[model samples]
Target: ALPDAIEEVSQADQDAFNQDGLGYLADKARTLDALPSDAWEPDLAAFDALIASLAIEGMPETGLMQGSWLWVGQRALGSDAPTPVLDPPAYEIAFGEGDVQVRADCKRADGTYAADGGMTGALSLTLNPTTMQICSEDSQADAFLTALSQVDRFAIAPGAHTMQLFLPDGSVMSFAQAE
Candidate 1:
């Protein structure tokens, strides 16, 4: 005869199951089953060449940062540099149609901008004055605006997922692209 109740599970066993281990395996099997038999063997060399071209397309272009981005924080050069920390809903900057939309904590602002020379490996950014509203005492509105004002150039990392704004004094403001 079988026991009516099962034994309790341990923490390690639960961890080993992952968040949805069985579900993950099931999905993978389903995907394989959905594939046509002809696709079982692929031209790996052709796929590799196509992927290489896609990488080139991702390289920086003028105003490549045009889109919404989430601020990851700022950092200055050298040994005393402070580590970047993310505060949820920190700040978001949007660039498009020759304009920049800023969300600085509790405050909001908008302005026009020009991006030139990115093709030459040097992207020059110029921003005009923006309309600003005062924010709470604990807000970093002032600092955020100040940093934007000082940005003269910018660079986008590989995969075009991260952008770094550069100031004349060598300060860097990093941001991750928004979905």
Candidate 2:
């Protein structure tokens, strides 16, 4: 359950959102002498429908799910709270590939340039029916990549590839197939 303060604030915000009805009242008030009273109902109805459709329970939001998970000790009445243990997080992104191969490096949460999120190196994957291998680098691209061939192998479906690089630290760096 959400906190009481959060719930109250959300309710107040929703009430405010509904009360103004897409700022029609303010817009009309600005042009009070310009437009007649009959030009309001249809616009109001459209705004109401938009608000109703945006309800969380009524509709589900779709996107990549990402967040950090942490473990913290409960605060004691007479003792100082323990420091929070920050567990590493996995960020999943999907992109297109011409062949049955996709490769990406584990980046920081901001996804700027690549930093070692403790994967082997850059993550490379090839997906064919019942065969999947997550390699550190592209063997076909360079002789050096082929030399570092300590690949972690797995099985996956053939048509499209979704790669997950499981770090030694028990978190996953995954990329879902991009649409």
Candidate 3:
């Protein structure tokens, strides 16, 4: 009994069992009082091929899990919005064994500063051990700065985390921590 429980079965054996048509084989064996003394190789090979061709699909993740921050924003600036456009918003992530520090800089192709060819105001985040602060250096860029201020603090763990930012006008940005 122990040997039967622990014994291994091979793919070939499995193929042979399936190919033999379990129901039919059982009936024939019962009627004949035993299996045919002749070879049953052809039926076994066909079953092996069928099992070999089968593929299994991957399953998606499921569980109750939460991240530090979650940012959600639109892909386009607005409907029929002109180019040299800026993204809605995006999240930034990093990892450290103890505590991690991360920074993000977001700027549009359009000029927000007086500097030539410089994108509008910069949106940056400085993440310390347990705290993350998002800020904008240029006061003239109130839209981005105000957006940064709305986010409070988040609790980060050793696993994955996310950050989300939203503007007063309802624009949003989000990022996630790496696994």
Report the number of the highest-lDDT candidate.
Answer: 1
Tens-place lDDT per residue, model 2, 109-149, is 11211222122223333332222444344222222122112
How many collisions per candidate?
0, 0, 10
lDDT string for model 1 (43-160, tens) is 5456545655664566543545556777787877532454464452568888765667887787777777666534213344354554466666777667877888878666777666
TM-score of each: 0.56, 0.17, 0.21
Please list all clashing residue pairs in model 1, or write none if there are none.
none
Ordered by lDDT, highest first, the candidates read 1, 3, 2
Model 3 pairs whose backbones collide? 69-162, 69-163, 70-164, 71-164, 71-174, 89-173, 90-174, 91-174, 91-175, 112-120
* Model 2's TM-score against the true structure: 0.17
lDDT winner, 2 or 3? 3
Q: Which candidate wins on TM-score?
A: 1
What is the Cα-based TM-score of model 1?
Answer: 0.56
Considering summed lDDT, which 10 consecutive residues are worst modelled in model 1? 117-126
lDDT of 3 by residue, 57-168 (tens): 5421111123222233322223232222132223322322222222233421121111111111123333323223443563222343334444322222333343433232
